[model samples]
Target: MAETKTPTPMFPVVQGGGSLIVAWQIKGKKVVVVGGGEVAAGRILNVLNADALVTVVCPALGLNPEVAYRVAQGQVTHVPRNFEPSDLDGADMVLVAVDDPAASSIIWNLCKERHIPANIADVPPECDFYFGSVHRDGPLQIMVSTNGKGPRLASTIRKFIAKQLPKDAGRAIESIGRLRIKLRQMAPDVEDGPKRMKWMIDVSDAYSWDDIGGLTDDDMDNLLKYYLSGDVPSLNVLKGLPDGKDASDIDLFDGSFGFSVGA
Candidate 1:
């Protein structure tokens, strides 16, 4: 008999804190934020934008203008008192942003006992999750984190990455979705899931509209036509227009979109 040896794993396993990143759905969920300073205000805004029902547990005097405005509008519930362990009740997630480490630790332990996810600002060991610099483009979002370390650096890197993306990235994404639907309708015979996925991947990697100056309505029509009846549109169809217009002038590729990212 020949000796058999187990093969090593392809990727090294990392063991440490804050190594996993995930997008959590907090919509319509109850989130408790325990602080009233600027950091807490930022977290509150993020939760509010996610449509989470938020409760802020802090003294009435310390709230920043943005948080106070939301409270006045009834967008968020204001506890108007210092955080207590009881504040964590009914919370799906908790963010401890208070300045007092003792109070934050108490809240973190309580949340752990109750099995609720908790994040304690500036304290990695006490946090169940860490807030990251986030960039949003319609349905697409990118989050960058430094494992509970150096948030400023993470934010700087995020801004640089954001600048490299096309301004109409979201619209481009929608156009790609429409193309996927058309491709599927045209290739109904490809039934296997893996085969269909591979076909989509190949088409996406091989297809390019750069030679045509970018994606345009005419280009989309031509693409559909090619897929359906093998007719290719003229490459010069969108070449000449008054005042230097080109395919990039098309709304689908126009660089006129903007997105907000939060730290």
Candidate 2:
């Protein structure tokens, strides 16, 4: 038999490298951007969207239309100068979008000393975090990242996934959230409260968007009753139950419970 050669791995293993994805609340926080170029403009837009106070430092604002419009609208403060160490003062986050490697490196070092998070455009090794492709549908947000290995690929994947999500997915989430709060309030003292809560969450997760989006007041009441008593009630019966009545006194059916308006 001929000796077989082992194939080499296509990608090199990066030691101590993995991204911890998190949604940072930057509202009312200070964000400093060093560079007035197109890259810097994009970063500014994202920061502004998060309701953060942005201060842009550059000799002159670049030809980015959004940046210019925001500056005109007084939404962003333009320092009209080159990057300086003092610019990072009181900054919750810093973004370096300048073309000069030396200036970006200096800013990155200053951010490290100040213990502030920083991102250097096109320089993954120097960046504290990468800006991933994000998709937002009302309150629901999905972010896709390639760990700085492939940004374009991540964007493409994000677009594909965005199209797959239902238009009313966010509404369904809100309805389930309301139901969960109600369940917790009603069954706070139950011995199997945690298990019951988990069951409710699983059922909510399995519900079709149309089913959740179209839920009525009676539907919510009956759904909660079904989970608690192992009996689904007809709409008329659900309406008949007195408000604030003890759930234990409800007449529960002995057989399987069906979640339907007519059940």
The CA lDDT of each predicted structure is: 0.74, 0.79
For residues 1-263, what per-residue lDDT tens digits would candidate 1 score against the true structure? 98999888899877775577887889999999888889998999889878999999888898989889889999999999887778877889998888899878888889889999989999998877788899888656789999888999999999999998867666666666766666676676755455556544554565443442255655554455444333333444323322344333443322244532221
TM-score of 1: 0.68
Report the error of model 2 at residue 253, Å.
14
Quickly count the clashes in candidate 2: 0
Tens digit of lDDT per residue, candidate 2, span 1-263?
99999889899966676798998899999999887778888899888878999998876545367677778899998888777788988999999898889878888988899999999999999988889999876567799999999999999999999889887888887887787787777777778677676767666665678677766665686568667554444434544566554334555343355443322
In order of appearance, the predictions have TM-scores of 0.68, 0.72
Clashing residue pairs in candidate 2 (N, C-alpha, C atoms within 3 angstroms): none
Give stretches of model 1 more than 4 Å off: 1-18, 177-192, 206-263
Worst 10 residues of 2 by lDDT: 254-263
Shift of residue 213 alpha carbon in model 2, Å: 2.4
Question: Each candidate's root-mean-square deviation in Å?
Answer: 10.8, 6.2
